[model samples]
Target: MPAEKKAYPLRISATVLEAMQRWADDELRSVNAQIEFVLRQALHNNGRLKPAKVKPLTDDDTR
Candidate 1:
Protein backbone atom coordinates (compact mmCIF):
# COMPACT_ATOMS: atom_id res chain seq x y z
CA MET A 1 0.00 0.00 0.00
CA PRO A 2 1.07 3.56 -0.60
CA ALA A 3 2.07 5.61 2.41
CA GLU A 4 -0.51 7.95 3.89
CA LYS A 5 0.05 11.60 3.03
CA LYS A 6 -0.55 14.70 5.15
CA ALA A 7 -1.16 18.14 3.71
CA TYR A 8 0.83 21.17 4.78
CA PRO A 9 0.54 24.80 3.70
CA LEU A 10 3.64 26.25 2.04
CA ARG A 11 4.66 29.83 1.47
CA ILE A 12 7.13 30.60 -1.33
CA SER A 13 8.41 33.56 -3.27
CA ALA A 14 7.10 34.14 -6.78
CA THR A 15 10.57 33.99 -8.36
CA VAL A 16 11.28 30.58 -6.84
CA LEU A 17 7.81 29.35 -7.66
CA GLU A 18 8.27 30.31 -11.30
CA ALA A 19 11.59 28.52 -11.50
CA MET A 20 10.13 25.43 -9.88
CA GLN A 21 7.20 25.51 -12.31
CA ARG A 22 9.56 25.57 -15.29
CA TRP A 23 11.61 22.70 -13.90
CA ALA A 24 8.50 20.69 -13.11
CA ASP A 25 7.19 21.24 -16.63
CA ASP A 26 10.46 20.08 -18.15
CA GLU A 27 10.32 16.90 -16.06
CA LEU A 28 6.61 16.35 -16.89
CA ARG A 29 5.61 16.36 -13.24
CA SER A 30 3.19 18.51 -11.28
CA VAL A 31 4.78 21.27 -9.17
CA ASN A 32 3.82 19.37 -6.02
CA ALA A 33 5.43 16.16 -7.28
CA GLN A 34 8.57 18.04 -8.25
CA ILE A 35 8.78 19.53 -4.79
CA GLU A 36 8.38 16.12 -3.14
CA PHE A 37 10.98 14.63 -5.47
CA VAL A 38 13.48 17.31 -4.51
CA LEU A 39 12.78 16.89 -0.81
CA ARG A 40 13.14 13.09 -1.06
CA GLN A 41 16.48 13.47 -2.84
CA ALA A 42 17.73 15.90 -0.23
CA LEU A 43 16.68 13.59 2.57
CA HIS A 44 18.40 10.63 0.94
CA ASN A 45 21.57 12.65 0.40
CA ASN A 46 21.58 13.57 4.07
CA GLY A 47 21.03 9.93 5.08
CA ARG A 48 17.66 10.74 6.64
CA LEU A 49 15.72 8.36 4.41
CA LYS A 50 16.65 4.97 3.04
CA PRO A 51 16.51 4.23 -0.68
CA ALA A 52 13.50 2.34 -1.94
CA LYS A 53 14.02 -1.05 -3.54
CA VAL A 54 12.37 -1.61 -6.89
CA LYS A 55 11.53 -5.03 -8.24
CA PRO A 56 13.01 -5.89 -11.61
CA LEU A 57 10.53 -6.22 -14.44
CA THR A 58 9.96 -9.68 -15.86
CA ASP A 59 8.19 -10.82 -19.03
CA ASP A 60 5.39 -12.34 -17.02
CA ASP A 61 4.91 -9.11 -15.09
CA THR A 62 4.72 -7.11 -18.28
CA ARG A 63 1.71 -8.99 -19.52
Candidate 2:
Protein backbone atom coordinates (compact mmCIF):
# COMPACT_ATOMS: atom_id res chain seq x y z
CA MET A 1 0.00 0.00 0.00
CA PRO A 2 1.13 3.53 -0.62
CA ALA A 3 1.59 6.00 2.19
CA GLU A 4 -1.43 8.22 2.79
CA LYS A 5 -1.27 11.92 2.16
CA LYS A 6 -2.50 14.57 4.54
CA ALA A 7 -4.33 17.67 3.40
CA TYR A 8 -4.11 21.18 4.78
CA PRO A 9 -5.79 24.40 3.76
CA LEU A 10 -3.39 26.98 2.36
CA ARG A 11 -3.79 30.66 1.57
CA ILE A 12 -1.74 32.43 -1.09
CA SER A 13 -1.85 35.51 -3.19
CA ALA A 14 -3.63 35.28 -6.54
CA THR A 15 -0.42 36.07 -8.36
CA VAL A 16 1.40 33.15 -6.81
CA LEU A 17 -1.48 30.78 -7.34
CA GLU A 18 -1.69 31.75 -11.00
CA ALA A 19 2.05 31.16 -11.41
CA MET A 20 1.79 27.75 -9.81
CA GLN A 21 -1.13 26.82 -12.03
CA ARG A 22 0.85 27.68 -15.13
CA TRP A 23 3.86 25.70 -13.92
CA ALA A 24 1.67 22.75 -13.03
CA ASP A 25 0.08 22.72 -16.47
CA ASP A 26 3.47 22.94 -18.14
CA GLU A 27 4.66 19.94 -16.09
CA LEU A 28 1.50 17.88 -16.80
CA ARG A 29 0.54 17.65 -13.16
CA SER A 30 -2.52 18.74 -11.27
CA VAL A 31 -2.12 21.87 -9.18
CA ASN A 32 -2.37 19.96 -5.94
CA ALA A 33 0.19 17.34 -7.01
CA GLN A 34 2.56 20.02 -8.24
CA ILE A 35 2.43 21.73 -4.88
CA GLU A 36 3.19 18.50 -3.07
CA PHE A 37 6.05 17.70 -5.44
CA VAL A 38 7.66 21.11 -4.91
CA LEU A 39 7.26 20.91 -1.14
CA ARG A 40 8.79 17.42 -1.02
CA GLN A 41 11.71 18.59 -3.13
CA ALA A 42 12.28 21.49 -0.77
CA LEU A 43 12.23 19.23 2.27
CA HIS A 44 14.59 16.72 0.65
CA ASN A 45 16.98 19.47 -0.40
CA ASN A 46 17.11 20.69 3.20
CA GLY A 47 17.85 17.17 4.56
CA ARG A 48 14.55 17.05 6.39
CA LEU A 49 13.39 13.83 4.73
CA LYS A 50 15.77 10.97 4.22
CA PRO A 51 15.40 9.00 0.99
CA ALA A 52 13.13 6.01 1.42
CA LYS A 53 14.73 2.59 1.36
CA VAL A 54 13.46 0.03 -1.10
CA LYS A 55 13.64 -3.66 -0.23
CA PRO A 56 13.08 -6.54 -2.60
CA LEU A 57 9.85 -8.31 -1.83
CA THR A 58 9.40 -12.06 -1.47
CA ASP A 59 6.17 -13.87 -2.25
CA ASP A 60 5.37 -13.89 1.45
CA ASP A 61 6.01 -10.15 1.66
CA THR A 62 3.52 -9.56 -1.13
CA ARG A 63 0.93 -11.54 0.73
Candidate 3:
Protein backbone atom coordinates (compact mmCIF):
# COMPACT_ATOMS: atom_id res chain seq x y z
CA MET A 1 0.00 0.00 0.00
CA PRO A 2 1.16 3.54 -0.64
CA ALA A 3 1.97 5.74 2.31
CA GLU A 4 -0.72 8.16 3.37
CA LYS A 5 0.01 11.85 2.89
CA LYS A 6 -1.03 14.68 5.19
CA ALA A 7 -1.25 18.27 4.05
CA TYR A 8 0.06 21.21 6.02
CA PRO A 9 -0.32 24.89 5.32
CA LEU A 10 2.91 26.73 4.70
CA ARG A 11 3.72 30.42 4.84
CA ILE A 12 6.72 31.72 2.89
CA SER A 13 8.25 34.93 1.70
CA ALA A 14 7.33 35.91 -1.87
CA THR A 15 10.96 35.96 -2.97
CA VAL A 16 11.61 32.44 -1.75
CA LEU A 17 8.41 31.13 -3.22
CA GLU A 18 9.15 32.65 -6.62
CA ALA A 19 12.61 31.13 -6.54
CA MET A 20 11.20 27.75 -5.66
CA GLN A 21 8.65 28.07 -8.44
CA ARG A 22 11.36 28.71 -11.02
CA TRP A 23 13.44 25.82 -9.70
CA ALA A 24 10.40 23.55 -9.78
CA ASP A 25 9.68 24.55 -13.38
CA ASP A 26 13.26 23.78 -14.39
CA GLU A 27 12.94 20.33 -12.80
CA LEU A 28 9.53 19.69 -14.39
CA ARG A 29 7.99 19.18 -10.96
CA SER A 30 5.18 20.94 -9.17
CA VAL A 31 6.17 23.26 -6.31
CA ASN A 32 4.84 20.81 -3.78
CA ALA A 33 6.81 17.95 -5.27
CA GLN A 34 9.95 20.07 -5.42
CA ILE A 35 9.60 20.96 -1.76
CA GLU A 36 9.02 17.35 -0.82
CA PHE A 37 12.02 16.26 -2.85
CA VAL A 38 14.25 18.78 -1.10
CA LEU A 39 12.94 17.84 2.33
CA ARG A 40 13.43 14.13 1.65
CA GLN A 41 16.97 14.72 0.43
CA ALA A 42 17.78 16.79 3.51
CA LEU A 43 16.37 14.12 5.79
CA HIS A 44 18.41 11.39 4.11
CA ASN A 45 21.59 13.48 4.22
CA ASN A 46 21.10 14.15 7.93
CA GLY A 47 20.49 10.46 8.70
CA ARG A 48 16.89 11.11 9.69
CA LEU A 49 15.62 9.02 6.78
CA LYS A 50 16.97 5.76 5.46
CA PRO A 51 17.73 5.28 1.80
CA ALA A 52 15.29 3.21 -0.17
CA LYS A 53 16.47 -0.12 -1.50
CA VAL A 54 15.48 -0.92 -5.05
CA LYS A 55 15.21 -4.51 -6.12
CA PRO A 56 17.27 -5.49 -9.11
CA LEU A 57 15.23 -6.19 -12.24
CA THR A 58 15.36 -9.65 -13.73
CA ASP A 59 14.44 -10.97 -17.17
CA ASP A 60 10.94 -11.92 -16.07
CA ASP A 61 10.41 -8.54 -14.42
CA THR A 62 10.73 -6.88 -17.80
CA ARG A 63 7.80 -8.78 -19.21
Q: Pick the candidate with the highest lDDT.
A: 1
> Which candidate tops TM-score?
1
Query: Candidate 1 lDDT, tens digit per residue, 1-63?
Result: 566899989999999999999999999999999999999999999999999887789999989
On a 0 to 1 TM-score scale, where does candidate 1 land against the true structure? Answer: 0.84
* Candidate 3 lDDT, 15-54, residue by residue in tens: 9999999999999999999999999999999999998877
Whole-model lDDT values for every prediction: 0.95, 0.91, 0.94
lDDT score, candidate 3: 0.94
- Candidate 2: what lDDT? 0.91
TM-score of each: 0.84, 0.78, 0.81
Worst 10 residues of 3 by lDDT: 1-10
lDDT of 2 by residue, 1-63 (tens): 677878899998999999999999999999999998998899999999887678788999977
Clash pairs, candidate 2, are: none
* Residue 32, candidate 2: alpha-carbon lDDT: 94
Clashes of 1: 0
Consecutive 10-residue window with the lowest summed lDDT within model 2: 49-58
